[model samples]
Target: MAPGTAERIARLIAPLRVKPGSRVDLARDFDPRYKGPLKKKDSAELLAVGVTLLAEYQQRLAAQDTYGVLLCLQALDAGGKDGTIRHVMSGVNPQGVKVSSFKVPSAEELGHDYLWRYAARLPARGDIAIFNRSHYEEVLVVRVHAEVLDRQRLPGDVRTADIWERRYREINAWERYLTDNGFRVVKVFLNLSKEEQRTRFMKRIDLPERNWKFSAADVRERRHWDEYQIAFSEMLSATSTKWAPWYVVPADRKWFARICTAAVLAHTLTGIDPQYPTVSDKARKDLLTARRELEAEAPKGAAADPYAARHRSAGG
Candidate 1:
């Protein structure tokens, strides 16, 4: 993490959280004085701070071999989950990061249990896993269009009213399970207003390159926007636990939303207080012995070429 790289990263992510014509007041939620673009200096400063904290988090994650999760960017269409991931995590160590994007389930997927893939996708110890859109879909998409669930033929004992409640209880217990086992869960709902989504939809239609983003089905879903919101709000209220809290991000102003998200994430990671594992004295002595032997037998050209070095990475 360079002096200002974190800030620049923050600027890049800022646009993903909120766009113009947003129904929510994101800037005001963070600070009413915040206006348009995040200046280079400010963004740079933010990134510097953000990266330092993430480095600490990465160290702690590795040392403790703890798993952490960033879950459920639950929002309407164009809520900026992709953007948030791209920008907010730019400062993180990619080696320990895994991202999963959940979409419409295939026939085979429908046949198995809903949690099947989710369980397999869980990050291993010492890793961070991000869910672009997650299992919450079972609640959101299923509730809005029962047709989707009808295909799966849910358990006969599952009642209509009890289904969602069961999920919420399972979600909270699951989060607590993770925490007790050394996992952290952070759920964020990108709360964008209908007005903002419409503006972005129109942008996709009007802009030549962005035209591909528009879909006729998206307009159809917009009609049920109220239903989705109620489901989302209810989900947030019911599942916002002490172990895993849900943050309500204002999705009106993209920059403000990005900053606030960064702030919150930074806050969470910092709370983990990760520290790099210290090398043992025995290991240090062994390294010194190896270094002495290497130095004694080393040739001038023993060092590798820079160009060849570029192709191979430490991860390999």
Candidate 2:
């Protein structure tokens, strides 16, 4: 990382973040087509740099094994969440990252509290976990269509008119608890314009390769777009806490959205600043002894090891 790169990234994303306690009216407050001063041509190079930074930080994070990161992504259909994940995380090692996509609740999941399934899938120490449409779905989707709550099996007393407000507070507190326990929660909402969403949907239908991505149900959900926007606004306002604030990434342009997403994640890991663990004195001594023993046994000629000459030529 270059000097002040982290600070630059922080500045780049400051405008996209939802400040804690701020009221959000998604349509009025954020422009889904906003790409700042960067043009489409700049995305590839910016994203490459972001990927390199992510890879470096991820290695240190894994080696340190002292903290975890959870990325919560929320988006409407055709909002580019999948593509954002694919491009932003392309350079990371698969072993250290887990992506969990949450759909409608399964019978088993509905049997437990709404957060149970999400909590169970949290990242282990030194790992990153991404939730595609996460626990916030409880507030967004269920709030949009209140009838979905009928299936949750909640106690009658708990299903009062103030249920949404209660859930918001509970979620904020839960995120605070995670932050205290060495886990950082990152939230992003892909803010896509209604026009852009329709355009993407048309492409999904017109292109054979993308047909599988389209669903009639997705189109059906379009009818409730206004309601969903309201739910999303409320969710952002209520849960964008200091511990886990939300970034509203403009999703009208896929390339711009990807780079912005990358910046947000890179900024996060940069702040955490995880480092490779330092060995203790006893461990260092054992390492020296092991090195000596290995050196004493390694007497093979160039002919014995096929790559010995190559290693020597490369100064290995």
Q: Best TM-score goes to which candidate?
A: 2
lDDT of each: 0.70, 0.92
Candidate 2's C-alpha runs over 4 A off are 300-316
After superposition, candidate 1 runs with Cα above 4 Å error: 1-48, 297-316
Top-lDDT structure, candidate number:
2
lDDT of 1 by residue, 78-192 (tens): 9887887787677777888889998888888888987766766877777888888887887788888989878887877875768888887887787788888877777777778
> Candidate 2 at residue 29, lDDT?
96
Residue 193, candidate 1: Cα error in Å is 1.2
Candidate 2, backbone clash total: 0
Candidate 1, pairs of clashing residues = 6-47, 7-43, 7-44, 7-47, 18-253, 18-254, 60-274
